[model samples]
Structures are given as C-alpha cells and as structure tokens.
Target chain A: MTHHTASAEELEALARHARWLVLSTVADAGAGHIGGPLSQMDLLLALYFNHLRIDPSDPHRDDRDRFVLSKGHTAIGLYTVLALRGYFDPAELATFDHGDSRLQGHPDMRMLPGIDASTGSLGQGLSVAVGMALGARLQQRDFHTWVLLGDGEIEEGMVWEAAYAASRYGLDNVTAIVDRNGLQQYGWPAGASDRFDRRDPWAGKDVGAIFRGFGWDVIDIDGHDHAEIDRALETACGARGSAGRPTVILAETVKGKGVSFTEGTYRWHNGIATADQLAAARAELGQPETVGVAR
Target chain B: MIAQRQVWGETLVELGASDDRIVVVDGDLANSTKADLFAAAHPERFVEVGIAEQNMVGIAFGLSTLGYRPWLSTFGVFLTHRALDPIRMLVSQTGAAVRIAGAYSGLLNGRSGKTHQDVADLAIMRTMPGMTVLAPADEHEMRAAVRWAADHDGPLYLRIARDAVAPVFDIDTTWEDWAPRMLRDGGDITVVSTGVQTSRCVDAVRLLADRGIDARHIHVPMLKPLDEDRLAGLLGERVVTVEEHTMIGGLGGLVAEIVAARRSTQTVTRLGLADGWSESGPDAFLLDKYGLSASRIADRIVGVHSRPVGTPGV
Candidate 1:
C-alpha cells in the first residue's frame, strides 16, 4: 500500500511507452479512440505507476485504492497502463475490442481485473467514486478513490450532481481528475463559407471555477507534466489543499498529444490509424518498427 | 389501512438496527418516501443526496461494490425515468446489489398528477437484466418484501404505492418462496393481479362470486423472475389480469407472454389504465374512473366471462 515514487523522468518515459501502446492497440484493433487516450496517457501513467496504492497481483483486495475511468471511451489508455503495471500480461492487450476478449471497447470491471468499476456511459463514474469514498468512511477504511473525467463529458448534468455530493459529504478521500484536452468528437461543423465555425463547444469553459463553485478544491496543472500531476495528486490525496473538501485537478492537455499529425486536432478523436501512420507514430516515439505485425 | 411507504421506512429502520452495513440514500423526499424514519434511527447511515436520483443510484452502485447494502428511495417515476440510464449501466449491467425503493408508484401520489404517478415502473424494472422486481399487495407483504430485498445480493426494485391500500395477506404471511399467492379459489375463471391492485382484485372476485361468476384470485408479488411454472399451473382456461399500470406491459403483459409461450388454450383479458394517462385525483376516484375499482373490475370480468369464445370482450 506504499507509493512507489518514480522520478519525473522515469514517469515521462513510462508515459511515452504507454502512449505507444495505446496508439498501437487502437491501430491494431482497426477501430478505437486515439486523441483522448493520447491526451490522458500521462495522467494515467502518473497515477498507476507512482500514486495509486494497488497491487496488481491482488487487484481485488478490499483496501486497495479504487480508480474509475468516468470518461471510459479512452479505455485503451487505462488498459495499457494496467498492462504495464503488471495487472495482466501486456500481450493479452492484443485481444482488446475483439469478440470474447476481456478487454472490451469500454472498461468492464466484471471482465477484467484492476478495473474498479464498469464504465462506458459518461458522467456516472464520479458518483460511483463518491459512493466508494463514503463507503470507506462508513467502514472506517483509509483507501482512497480517484476518478478520471473528460472535459467534454462534463456536459452531463449528472457529473455536477456527483460533484455537489462529493463536496456536501466532505469526501476528502476521493479526487477527481479532468482531462482538459480542449476537443470532442463532434461540434459546430464548419459551413462551406465559414471554416472558423468548426470548434469544440466544450473548449474554453471555466471547468475549474465550476468545480470550485461546487465546493471542491481546484488544482490547475499541465496534465502531460508528470511532476505537476504527481504534485497535485499528492496534495489532493493528503487532503492538504482544502481539508474536508474533495479536490478536482483540471489537467490542461492537448487532444492527441505526442503525435505531430494528431496533436491538438479533433480528427483523430476516434479513428483507425493506417499502417503508414502507425509506423510514423512509432518512429516519432523512438520505437523500433516491426514488419507484417498489426500490433 | 397502512401506506406501503410507511411499512418500507419502518422495515428499513428495523433492518438497520441489526445490520450496520445497511445504508439508505434518499433524493430529498425523505419525509414523503418515509425514509425519514430510517434517517432518524440511523443518521450516519442515511445519505441525503438532494433531488438527484441518478446520482443517488450511482452512489448506491458504488456502495454496493464495497459490501454495503444501500437502498435508494425516491419516486418511482424519477427512479425509472430520470435515473434509468445509471440504473441500467451501473446497477443492472454490473449486477450490483443495490435496492431501489420506488415510492409513489401507480396512480396514487396524493394528487401529484401524471408527472409523479408511475404506472409503468413494473414494466421498466422487469425488463432490466438481473433485476428482481417486486410489488407488494399491502403493508404485510411490503414488510416481507423489504426483508427479502435486504437478504438478496443482487439488483432489486421494490414498487411502493403512495396511498394506504386494503390488506390482502395476513400479518404473518411471508415471502418464503417466489410463488403467486392464491387469495381465493373458484372454478369458472382466474383473476390475477399485482401490487395494490391485488387487494382490489380480491374484493372484485368476491363481487364476481355474488354475481355467480366463480372467479379465482391470484396475487403475484414478484413480477420479474416470476414463478411461471407455478402460475401457469394455477391458471384456468380463462384468465383476466388487473393492475394499476398500463395494460401493455405490466402484469397483463407478463401473463400474456407466459400464456402465449406455454401455448395453452387460455384466454387473457387484460384490464388496466386503458392505453392513456390518468388525471390527478384521490386513489379511490382514480381507480373507479380507470375501471380498476372492485366493482368496476368485477363488472369487466363479468363482461369477459359472458362473452363467447374467440370474440373480444370489454
């Protein structure tokens, strides 16, 4: 249950490896989300590798810290992190999104270990984390609950409802991490005459202020920075930022980070990467190329 | 006569005394849903989640994963309509052991009108995978159903009527098994009902006997995972279903599905809120207007009984 603190440099290396795994997994599956996973990879790597108090061998231990991916569409990122964390063999990830595979299109807690809750529908996992925090209080357990949400997914009213509950209950044991990637799949499409009309409607909203209004302690950090992610997570878990109030870390990030072509664009939000594109992405990440292997 | 919500609140308090793992989550209607009694008895275990039913359900799902038995109390309409997505994704899909106490079910919410009245909760809950749907006939059955729900370790939905209903079962009667209770025995035709309507059906069967109809009455407390074999065995050639819900998909739909799948020669006459919404009124007035009162139900059964085979009856 002790934190295996990794240096920022080691965490950055881990994030790069996880990003490669995420993109390769999605491209091999021929269908999966790319942008959100790439954007959220650093946050997941920082939490799973350095922060979360979980044992991969005993994933279902009662006192283990729980993590829920509220914006579950980017499950490939979480799956890659779990694989690298030794919860399962990294080789098993090849079956992701395949029929009868434990790695589903969305995270299925019942089907896979280390997955705390089954979540695909957005905006519900934070409430589940709040309940887990409450349960820990009622049971007198010290385990913490961490939930990752998407900036666009916050459009759901249920997310705010959970935000209010987490604050009203004084759930200091739970922390919410928002991937402020500044893009979504669909938005105001550009008309023929106006190319500037196309943009993410959820981008530029004051998400941290809204969470603060909900009585949460807001921490703004660069999501792709491992040191900032680690620091914010530590402050939140220590209940040092604002005692008796849940903390929400609005991690500013770019959609499709770490890839030159996909970064900051919504086109790669969810699509298959062609063979050449996958090779280019691997080459960019400094990974050796393999011939005739989709994965 | 006692309201089912009252029994639910009292039973929750009783359960909380023995099991500390029991928690109650309410959506700001604690007093109306009678969850206030449990909150008073066990303040720490009671979670007041404001007017957010969907969040209440999600919280209960999370608690269920942590080995806590959390019961969410709210109006049936909100639980089944507004919070159905969470109930489906978090509770039903994962088979979480979260109990949903859907109060103000049916057409009797103290004149709260159609918005508060829940006439289709049974149909919605019954169709959810791994969901145990129950509608007690009266206070006695409500007490038993609450206890059963606590002991059960899966997703469950308890439909509770807002108004006081006539008792159909004895005080000592318990839901020891999932079988439809036969309240009356006769030979001519079978009358099956669920929830509060079962009590009215009991009275209607008595009135039918007075008219020489010889009706048999059956009360099904458990709607989902229904005791189909037992119910199918007890059904006669002519079966009439009565409920406070819509005729399309409640008890009537269940009976029709069972009979048709059995391929038996039985004819099902479904009597309910005839394909429309009901206006807000007193429970008795609404029942009478919707052809669900004891006398009206008896009259409808008579029409069905006297009609010749292969012809539609009123």
Candidate 2:
C-alpha cells in the first residue's frame, strides 16, 4: 500500500497525479466520464511512469513505446496521464472539449502530443497497436506497444480479431490490458445477456485458454494493484518471438473504483462531475493530500 | 461499365512495384474485394485479416503511422458500417494517411439486398472531419484517383462502383490535379457530376449539343473539401448537379449549397436518387429508373433551359 523503491514511489505519485488531473479537468467543465477515467487512472499512471520507456518531451521519438487508449470515450483518463507526465502543459487540461481545444471527447492524435493513435470508437485501438508492434519488429525497433480496452468494448468482434492476429504473429512485444469494470453502459455485463448465468463471463469462457489457443501468454491481475501490474509487464518484457506467444494482462477493476455512488453501477459509466459531485469524488480519491491543483 | 474495383486493384499493383512502402490490407473477401492482384504481386506487403473489417482498418492505420502507404480494401457496406468505429477512430481520430477502397459501392451489388448496398456511404464518410472521399466516374478516373491517394496526405475513402462501366475519359489525356476536372465547358449551364453518373453526364452533354444547347460538364472526383472557389468562379450561377446517389447529402446537395451561397444568376437543377429505398434491378436499369442516365439528365437540362431567365427558385 505504501511505496519504498524510488521507481515505485515515482510511479505511485504519477498515478495519484493522474487521478487529480482527471478530477480537476473534467470537474472544471462540469461534465465528463468521471467514473471510467477514475477506474483506469492507476493503470495508465503505472504504464507511463514505470513500464513504458517514453520521454514526455519527445513523444514522437523513434523507438519509444506506444500506448493507445482504445476505450476512447474515457479520454479524460488519457488526458490526465498526458498532462501529469508533462506531454503538454497541465494548463492545457483546462481546455478539454472546449471550442478550439485539441482535447476532444476521444483521442485526436493529430491535434495533441503523446497520442500514438486517435481512438474514440471502441474495439479498434488494439488492432492498431498490433500493427505498431508488427512495424516495430519489421524496422528492428525493439519497442513495446500497450493497448487499454474497456470491459464493454470486449463484446465487439474486432477485439477477438486483433487478439487472434497478435497471437498468430507471436507479438510478444505487444500487451493488452482490459479494464474489467464488470459494468458497461446499459447494465451489468453478465445481465446484458441471458446466454450465461455466471456473474463473470470472462472467467467461465476461459479468456486465457482462448488466447492460449492463438498462442498468447495470458495473465490476469488486479488493475489497481501496482505490484502485480509491474511484475506482469516485467514478465512480458522477457518474451521472445520464437516463443510463439503474445501477452495479455486481464486487469480486474471496479467500474467506478474509488467513488461511492458510482462504484459497481452501470449508470456512472459516463456520469458527469457536478460541483458537489466533484467535491465528493475529491474527498473519496484523497486528491488534495496526494496532488495539489493549480487553482 | 468497368468496375472501379478493378482499376483500384491494378493501380495498387503499379504503386507496389515502384514503392516498397505501398501495402494492401483486405478483409476476408479478398477475391470479391479485388485486392488479390496486389496480394499476388507483393506477397510481403499484402495482408488478409480474415472477415474482420474493424481489424483490417485498424491495421492499415498502424501501417500508415509507421511510414507505409496502406490501401485497405473491403465491401462498401461492411467497410463503412461495420468498421465505422475504426474508420472514425483510427482513420479520422489519428489522422492516419491510409487509403480505404470500398468495392460493391451503392446498389452495384444487385442481388445482395439492403444490408450489402451502401446507399449512404458518401454521406456518412463526408461527415467525418479530414476524410477525403473519391467516387471515380469510370476506370480511367479510378486509376488516377488511386495514384493521387497514394501521394496525398490524410485519410481517403474510395467508393468503387461494382457495375461494368465504359471509360469516360482516355488515360492518355493526362489529368494530374486532385480538383474536379472540366470535361466540357459552356457558359449556358454547368452540369456538375460525380462517380458513376459522370459517364451519363458525358452522354447528356452530347445529346444537349445535338439539340443546339451548350451544356458545360464538370466531373468531380473528390467529394470532400469541395473546390467551391474555383467552381463559383467558373460556374457563375448556372449549375445542374447529377449523381447515382441520394439527392439528400450527395453531389446534388453539395453543388446546390455552393450555387446558392454564390447566388450567380443561373438556376440550379438536381438529378439523383429520391428519398427512399431504391428498387432492385441491374445497375443501368436502376440508373435509368432514377433518371440518372444520360437521357434523364438531358431531360432535366431541357426543363431548366425552358425556365424563365429572371426566375431563380430558392
């Protein structure tokens, strides 16, 4: 729960900072998918601050790792990470979705820095990441690619398509993390369909087995737990193409993790942050004590 | 009528031969999609993502970002509808300079029914910011469009009609610019045409000339980023827009907006599909039924010429 290693402390601070960034940016506008962003903050924080070898100042630097937020509707999470990591001045976060602001509802790679690909439509980001991984191998660039997917987005057939190809090519340099929040927009993922009686379809279907069939090393872990995410990423770092497998990190997380009203509820997938709601969210996230806001 | 898909495939092969970075990615329907030519010529650069249009588009975006000129081919219906998420996200969002070739465009796929016919592809694609749409009039124009797309920056969606259409222009004529080309010029009236209907417009021009009427023909290859300034300067006011697409949000609508904005003394007439589901028939039969063929367009020109000079309808 507490940080000891400098790298660990630095990463934890970045994750905490990303949390504050999302809270303040979206809160200022009085709207945003505060829940989804809050849920994925820790994962993005860990990737940018610890796992990925990227320079914020040199975002387009050749040989740098690529990260794509395929769940683009939750761009607040990515904006938070980008701003906190200094990809752009934190002041730019104030202009999120405003007229003339490059910070759109989804990732717009052309208009902003530190964006590998523009992704707002769900279930496409991972496939693009696969190509990035393939291109890296062809060019002999040794960089890894990471894709963040939403639990609801998994329902899209394209996710499986990319998964199959990634395994087919033995793309060990590529890693996919599912923000398994259990709830999508309409209802609980399990209740969305009458086909299954289980609470979690991901488990019964053997997600690992499916990936293994396509020759992928699948690992499931707690998304909020930094130590586990770090270890899994480290293991992926050692994989070789000859090994005939890619890597998947199935991260289990609450839909609105850290917030009381929105947590575990589908209604908050895209809930707005009102003035009172922002205060309540800040108190729950321990925002002020962790990272100071400029205002 | 030659299928534009053939031209797209052939031009891609030519691009592949000279440019190593020219790559083709197709959905599972490679044979029907007509990307097999590029596959056979450059096996290393061609990829087939089995039945996954979303993944196909996404991979193309990845390839484009890595300095490769990727040509993604798929059925128009699936490419525009099923892959909308990727098309909007990966292509529009990232601003990837990828070229997307959609075969079986419009109702060219006769027997496939509603699900397969992409009646609204142009309308949908044009709505996306920074997307360049090209519906080449015939094989000659199709080849030129593909060649231009390879060198052009930003995302491009190419709608290739399936029906076999006659070549409207000779390849040796040398059309180099990305802007709309003036096939035949006259001050009396400017007939704006796009895609499959350009061939009809050519025929209409000849018919009007026979009737002692001078009708100008302007063939637009690129739909988005409309060349309004040039169009307004040349057209002045007299314009009739024609297309084998819906009158709503198609070529007709685009030209009408420009002509209206400029308010040049010439009256505007539109000939396109009516606001409803199109009746099933052979491609030519459908064009004829919708008054999109040469005879139908010529009739529209005559009707416009008959109108009083002082009367310009809003």
Against the true structure, whose DockQ is highest? 1
lDDT of each: 0.88, 0.77
TM-score of each: 0.97, 0.86
For model 1, how does the per-residue alpha-carbon lDDT over A1-295 read when each residue is reduced to its tens digit?
Answer: 6476678888777777778888888878888999999999999988888889988999999989999999999999999989888889888878989789999999999999899999999899999999999999888899889999998798899999999999998889999999988777876664443222346545445677778899999999999877788889989999932499999999988889998888877888998887888878888887666522255
Q: What are the per-residue Cα lDDT tens digits for candidate 2 across B1-314? A: 55777777888889889987788888877788779988999888887777888888888888788898788878888888888877887787667888878788876685665568787788888988999999888888888888777778898889898776768878743455658878898867788888877887899999999988898888888888777787666663567788777778877777777766866666666677778886567766876776777887898788887777655632
Model-by-model DockQ, in order:
0.87, 0.68
TM-score of candidate 1 restricted to chain B?
A: 0.98
lDDT of 2 at A284: 71
| Span of ten consecutive residues with least summed lDDT in model 2 chain A | A192-201
- Judge the docking of candidate 1 as incorrect, acceptable, medium or high: high
Q: What is the lDDT of residue A30 in candidate 2?
A: 56
